[model samples]
Target: MSLVGSNPTLSATVRWLRVHWGTGSQVKNRTIKWLLGLAWVTAGLYFADKGATYYRQGRTLPPSVINTIPEMPPHRAGDRVLVFAPHPDDEALGCAGVIQQAVQAGAQVWVVYMTSGDGFRLAVERQFRQSHPSPELHIQFGKMRQQEARRAMRLLGLADWRILFLGYPDRGLYPLWSSNWTPSNALRSYYTDTDTNPYRDTLHPGVTYCGQNVLRDVEQVLRRTVPTHVYVTHPADDHPDHAATALFVMSALARLRMQGIGFAQRVVLRHYMVHCGDWPQPQGLHEDEPLTPPPAFFNIGLHWVKLNLTPPQQVRKMNAIKAHTSQMLMMSRFLQSFVRQNELFIEQPVVLPIEASLGVVWEEPDEEDILRNLQAPGDFSAAELRMENGQAVFHINTRSKPRPGFSYSCTVHALLPNGDVTTTLLRTKPGRQSADARVDEDGVTFRLPALPSGSVLVLQAQSRFAGLAVDKTIGHVVRLP
Candidate 1:
């Protein structure tokens, strides 16, 4: 059988010729064979071209990306746990062990699927479009998927209700995000158990659209779940859906933090690799024994909670993956069919110093806004902000305590309204601990030139005293005068 897509022209002609060439078979058989050979060659080009286009257009992952395996950082079991699975099977592949371990340790666990992955529906539809690939046909497939999920959860020994499906079209997600595809087509009007319907106005008006509900649902899930921790798929995973899902979780976490509705006891965050590069070790990784200790992004730490896979739990995990049948036929080699004894994750802590984030709050707010906005008076030192133009404008005037043999420089990363960047380096002679750089009415004269105007600036101070690594890349962003 042809590996994929459409009937081969040679096969068609070969049958035709064999029947007609019975008597004259020897005379013209060689010619027919040669002609059919050309047809196969041309057909091969067509498939190759199609693959090239799909990848170049970013509809598919590149070979390198398709073969990547992800790593999770290390962390304690009692800490909050989060899992971002790109597709249904991904959770099983990347973080199942984490889930098992977290549950055992009484750590909260949450898994988010970025997309519903129904693209293969179309391919399946093509098999017998006239007879079997009907609206009901595709919907049945969905039911099959849900059933598979239930079966898998049982095997994994996971509490059934813990799983959630955002119901995005499986393969079409990348095209929707990076190309011209639309989420509504799949989320709102997919061939579900019922007829096509708008996502917001679904047959079951209560059944929310996957795209619209993902963010809001996740927000609610967070509040209700009250998870002390959050987990998501890797951000750099080659699969666009996986990356997008991780970014969305991060965004939700940011919003929740802003509302001050959640408790913070160092909610550690790290990525679980899945999808392209999420699995199938990258060239360097495979070549280098245990993979270049996963790039720091995936290298949270090696320590992980190991789950004792019971017979039922193992079956459930395997079944959960096998539930995604459409994908299995296409990539059975890569597809999961059995549960391994262990699941892995990274727990790399993205530690932003308090000052780095609160630099804005640390500012001396305009005495006017604070005085007017504040009904009660407290020491306003924490709320002051002084707005000005150029490098010299906002800098606090330096009370000089010249340091020996040291030099000071500041590179201001200013974000312009037009979305372009304007950088200006301000320099000064090194000052003692008690003497930080300063500014005044005359524009504080750092050792360098004046900076340009912009809405926000990320100031980097340097004199070769340090850089960031596992050791010391602390306090990168600083508020200027």
Candidate 2:
């Protein structure tokens, strides 16, 4: 079992068995069978160790984290709350406690579902027991998810009219933000069988499935509701939809601020993490356990807070999450892990106040400390972001130079103040990995649209060698001087 890998004694036994039975001179049928069994055990051990390390490190929060358990804010009589979810069940999983508390305090609350959550193909297939289902069936699945969200929110004491759905394409928000900015080339939702918003219940029913439209819709919601506290997904979430939805929310808030109507520094921006890789360790029903943020985030420049729940509140939260029957059927145990004694949230400022510059600026010693220990020397060395010739230039320095016939890609996203983003996607081998797909490999330089003041740049570089991703890095950089 993979659990054996987490224990040194068990893992050692498995390793010893592998060495004794595998790579031997005898090639008998029984020998082969023993070798196969040993191989499986070895693999299980490897994965178990990985999972163990992840959870162990997460529980050991960094020393620099002050206010590790800050006072949970008491709800005001007329407090307004908004929760933005990339999917339906996420709201209940991450913010059910907050919602219940706010409603109990007579605070107005609104829950916005960004997508129909129709992209969960595995759950749908499992539910239908079909390898392939019709597009109409997929739409029906989306509708089911919507109903599940309604039931979940209702359990949290939210009125049906207070829940809003944007009806965007599930799992395709990042692409819509990256390439499909115009109505003509809007990202089509294969599941819903509509290119633009088709749900009559959506905030903007006819809005096109694009980044700008999503931003506008979010802005409209903010302006209409004027919530005092806005809760959205973390930007570093592993899910593309979760990350992009956060970006969209920030963009909308930025535009509203620019127009002198946005919440700006007045409203509280609380972030909840629903999707991260192997987080909230010991995933199962542990209602008495306390939930903590992953260790990687302690020094990541966000102030985290925990909402301690009463026994009754925890039970209510658990019941609300279970209301999402569509998702619960697929991953009930994983869902129950969130119904712990407390919920974690972070307060992050959305503004990046960088001064406008007319000339090039550079920051040296660009190696990211986080990656230094995680990656090899030749994987990724340094990164630089500079403004030159009216454009934002990004250089990702990699020590492991790309070889001929290999594939390399540089993905860059620039977050601007006006809620608009410019992305540059470059690849050495396009379409095919033939020899002709080679290119100059001195380093990867991406040219993005000129970044205005108050912007931040995020860069990711990866390389594929011999059909394997041998090197990759999420680069870091200092702001323009």
Candidate 3:
């Protein structure tokens, strides 16, 4: 009944083994066979581990790649620079070197923080030594972080007057960008328990926690400062707040362009990334290593740039990072990772008004896939906006058919020539489609209300499952012909 009797190859192998080992030494033969099997298994595991390491290395850009990127133009006298940060320490982490160089070069520098960074529960818990901190305590923590930012900027040679905090919710920026865009349905901060800006020193104290107010604040800042160079977070950052900050800043710039603000066209924009997957390798402090862009962004059409820092500049940058004591307490190593020989940035192209047809394609890099573990319900591959049959048509293409429990939505914010704002949205839920939207096997298409000529539309597409954003596209601005 043994399979060796029915299988010619197996029976021949068994007869050969017996002849080679001799049946009298059967015990020794068995021991040798066991040892051989163990060796093969061990070798297989070792090779697998090595292959995995090589795969990871392929996804991480080496530090020396910074040399290939062009150097950021040095700031000179009369140059006005504005740096926007999603949180207090972000400025120090990403732009401290730039701030120092600009200040030393006699350029005016201003730092605007979108949030107080009070929503971090772990930091508050550590600072207060409490498992459950109250809303008042969170507010107090925010104030403390603001002071830390001031000190950090001072260390980088910036004056107190040049620092501005908008005092918006730390973790609620995306909601403002997507859902709660109107003042009437303002979002409340989970930590501060407030539905409005509470910091008295902010530019617009008591401004509602809504998208419009956030955009308005950014526009006002741009009008007043009129920065020649603007630095903000990258849109593809892993953090939602960081991504939303970019969206809001870009939207404000788009609105300014619609209003015929010439400054918006003249200003230079650069995006810095602080959050990516295990970037700035060999984390912690490696001042000799240059900051390099993550490999996930290598093919994303970004013009990479670098700014090499002198030894003194690097030292000052480190000191400024330490000034963020609240954040250093929790992530000192991660913050210190930015104190490198050079800082990295992407030279953002000027926002131009898109006329007639607009098409945007989002190809997710393999390394940046957020849904690597879970089954991706769906992901955006491309989106287009055009006028069809005298109506505005928005189309989104997905990589695969959307699964049940997944939802997709598209929002368009139009700024009329008269300064009026009109918002339109179309969303499709599992097994249900909005009146304005048509969902098919490949993607979703939405029909928008007719927009007036000269109106600028900011469009965003997002996909979610279980109320969590899984994939999204950066805000695209288009002008009606």
Candidate 4:
């Protein structure tokens, strides 16, 4: 009887051990499988996001009048051409074909690089594989980029002396224009760690990085070069520096004309864009293909000029673009996208005449302007402009209902007939207010005093939604009764 009891106990203990070991092994296997699944999910999400960006970039061009516009004719002999680049490589990227054509026609070509463009953090990182680089390192990178620009222009047949580097801060030009309008209040360079021009061989060494100084240098260049045709960055470009550079050039021209500078009257303005949203589609080398304008700009009322390249001209442009080794090393695809068989430009913005008798005119903001008005990943629609007697109103409409406890605000300004400017700020009510107050459920309206005789109207609109604020500023010239 004792032997039989001992055997039964031993058998039970053995069975318990087997069950425990089997369960532990199975749990271990399941945990490993779960971890593998999670890793795959994370990787899938990452690649999906990258693929979506490239997919958006590959979108096709819509049918539009851009296709019907005539290609730019070849340059006439002795054509004095001036190309203004906000950054080093922009001259090669946007105007390579034109540069080659001008050189072949024996036209005098001058290339002006507004900034060394050393502030592109990603480009710096990619070039040096350094994370958290210091400001001094950025200046070094800027120097390298300047050298690259020189080589690129030389490859395009431009003489060394013809290329001028203004050595302004790469990314600070817009801020300088917006706030630091004087030499005493110059905007400091975030990359160069200095507030004044520091690069060698600049047009004006030691010039402060301010609107006053930038305009002064631009005007000086215009007066000295007396270019018959001038090419600059587009006004609606998404890049702040690019847009500001164009504005500075335009403002300088206006200032010169206002002062009765004779040469300003003869210069023709052409604008090019390099920083638009997914423009110049098929974002790689599409040899023999034509470069077309973005569909969003179809009705913006600007005339586009196209320059078709000869076979050799296209090849030379590609070679010149390739000469931007630092940029090509990182964004080769984007750089090559501009080496197509044609280039494009738009005539400078002309003052849109607002009929005095009509009393009111509604102007819709560009899609880019609407996109910029969003603070987060949200939807926004049109920002409509209305002008009337003694009042200018801005109505910003949103497609998506804003989050709870949200409101809107705007600033209205009048460019008075006598060149004086005035501004008023308006905040929408929380739950609705007076009609004259111009508050509505779908959007907010901001009313300003009537524009002065021969004055212009400007609107700076903002939205407060769930701790996020969206803002955009726009302006237009107005006609007075």
Judging by TM-score against the true structure, name the best candidate: 3
Residue by residue across 1-481, what tens digits does model 4's lDDT show? 0000012344575576556556777765865686689789889867865764565455445435457876766788879999999988888878998888888899999998888887877777667788656777777888888788888888889888999989888778767766677777888876567998887778988888887778789888988898888898875676778877876777666556545677676778888888766667878998867787865565555578898888888888888888777777777898888887688888754234455444433333244432333432222345555565545555666655444466665544444555444545566645655544555556566665655556655444555656444434333333334
lDDT score of residue 429 within candidate 4: 47
Model 3: per-residue Cα lDDT over 1-481, one tens digit each: 0000022354576677667665566766785887699789889867865664456556677766776888878999999999999999899888998999999999999999999888887788889998778889888988999999999999998889999999899888878987888999899887788998888878888999998899889998999999999999987787879988887888788778777788887888889998876676767999988887888677666688899999999999999989989888888888899999989888765553544555334445445333443534456666667677657787877777777877888877877888887777778855787668877788778888777777777777778877766777656666677
- Shift in Å, residue 273, candidate 3: 1.3
List RMSD in Å for every model shown.
18.7, 9.5, 14.8, 14.7
TM-score of 1: 0.48
Q: Count the backbone clashes (under 3 Å) in each candidate.
A: 47, 0, 0, 3
Which structure is stronger by lDDT: 1 or 3?
A: 3
TM-score against native, each model: 0.48, 0.73, 0.83, 0.74
- Per the 3 Å backbone cut-off, how many clashing residue pairs does candidate 1 have? 47
Q: Could you say which candidate leads in lDDT?
A: 3
Residue pairs of candidate 4 with colliding backbone atoms: 72-306, 390-450, 391-450
**Runs of candidate 1 exceeding 4 Å displacement:** 1-82, 108-110, 126-136, 171-213, 277-320, 323-326, 337-344, 348-481
lDDT of 2: 0.68
Q: Which residue runs of candidate 4 sit more than 4 Å off their true CA positions?
A: 1-59, 62-66, 126-129, 358-387, 390-481
Better of 2 and 4 by TM-score: 4
Write one digit per residue (lDDT tens) for candidate 2, span 1-481: 0000022355576677677665556644666687689899889868865765554545544333424568569677688999999998888888998999999999999999998887776667776787665667666778888888898888889989999999888887867755786677788775555787767777787788887677678888888889899998876666768867776787667556655674554888888887654566678888877787766555544578888789998888888888888777878887898888788887866554434364322222222223333233234445555566555665655554544545666665565556565666666642344221233354455565555655655555566655545454433322332
Instruction: Identify the runs in model 2 with alpha carbons over 4 angstroms from their true place.
Output: 1-67, 355-447, 451-481
Candidate 1 C-alpha lDDT tens digits along 310-411: 555455555566665665666655554224433444443332222322333232211122122221111112211243333322232222322334344444
